[model samples]
Target: MTSPTRILILEDDDGLRTSLRLVLEDEGYAVFEASDAEKALLTVEDPGVDLMLVDLMLGGMDGFSFIARARPRTEAPIVVVSARDRTEDIVAALEAGADDYVTKPFSVEEVQARLRALLRRPTIGDAETEDADDDVLTLDSRTPLLFDAGAAVLRRGEEEVHLTQTEFRLLSVLAEHAGKVLTRTALLQHVWDQDYFGDERIVDVHVRRLRKKLEVDSANPQILVTVRGLGYRLDTA
Candidate 1:
């Protein structure tokens, strides 16, 4: 039998962490809890961990530092659950390696849905059918960047590129519609599988992140280009 999806919850707030654990356990996940970033780091390295829920304000080390440190250890998606609602905070968390972000006072349903969406995402080497037309997309010939959909991997020549789940999803959507400018709204719906209105910055952040990986020069991106006042397009040509 397939093992239950493992989720690590790192929050200093005892009440909130316990409540989240109860709710998540009830939903059939293999939930693990940590009251601080230091403890969470101990669990983040486990390859069995499928996801992580982290709070920014934590005793010692902070959530951002934990995420940055843990990122190289595991490919599991990290979702920041914090009271910070500012755009800068969200962007900072994403920059620090968070796959997604949730603000304080968020509903249990929203948190659950976010986790479900993240866990449902296909990982590299997952045996799954392709949804896009081309199973492999060539981003640039010179740089030799390619996204192999069936393998759930992006490669630059012989080297396999490491990408966060959210980043992969964003690239997949853009690759499926290569040469077509997709608005931030459409990208949000397709990649995140949510309306996520007014949070287009999420797309922008991931796109910037992707550019760093997919382009030789992120500052002068050609493969993934943004259209002025419109949106973004992945040029396979």
Candidate 2:
């Protein structure tokens, strides 16, 4: 059997922590709780943890500091759950190694969905099947493919590809399904988290950016190739 996904919640607020523990446990995740950065560090010592949800404001060391210290020790994805809603706060958390962020008063379902998506994401070398086209795209076998469900940092071989948040999510959805040709609408829905009234240019611009990062010669692409009149596919051949 596949091991259970372990999740750590580091929030100083007792009520929020308790509620998250209850809700996430009900969602069938192994939950660990910590009220401060100090305890969070200790909790992460257990290698079984698959992901983390940390609050930006803690009693002593803030979540950003905790992330700075903890990142070197673990490869688990961290998602910041905080009351701070400013753009600066979000940017800071992402810069500090958080894979995602959630604001206060958010729905439990949304949080759970985001967590599931992050956990479901195949990091570098887990097993993956080829699409119907018989194309097999594998992430770099040498290094772990770090993804922050909120931003795009594509690592093709040895170089890290810098991408905007939108571009990152767009590439991530495609990378997850490496050899498949995803439709424009499917990309918009899954990556943009929206369904209707979307601009196709949004997809084009991000795909261009992703290609620039993933391809050795962007002018003559190799990895992210376009299918005529259909969409795009990560050439896994």
Best by lDDT: 1
- The lDDT values for all models are 0.84, 0.70
lDDT per residue (tens digit) for residues 31-103 in model 2 = 9999989888988986547899999888899999999888777778887888898777776776666766778
lDDT of 1 by residue, 33-99 (tens): 9997877888876544889999999878999899999888888898899999998999999898888
- What residue pairs clash in candidate 1, if any at all? none
Q: Record all residue pairs in model 2 with backbone atoms less than 3 Å apart, i.e. clashing.
A: 136-236, 137-236, 152-168
C-alpha-based local distance difference test score of model 1: 0.84
Model 2 residue 14 CA deviation in Å: 0.7
**In candidate 2, how many Å is residue 235 off?**
14
Q: Which parts of model 2 are misplaced by more than 4 Å?
A: 129-237
Candidate 1 Cα errors over 4 Å, as ranges: 129-142, 194-198
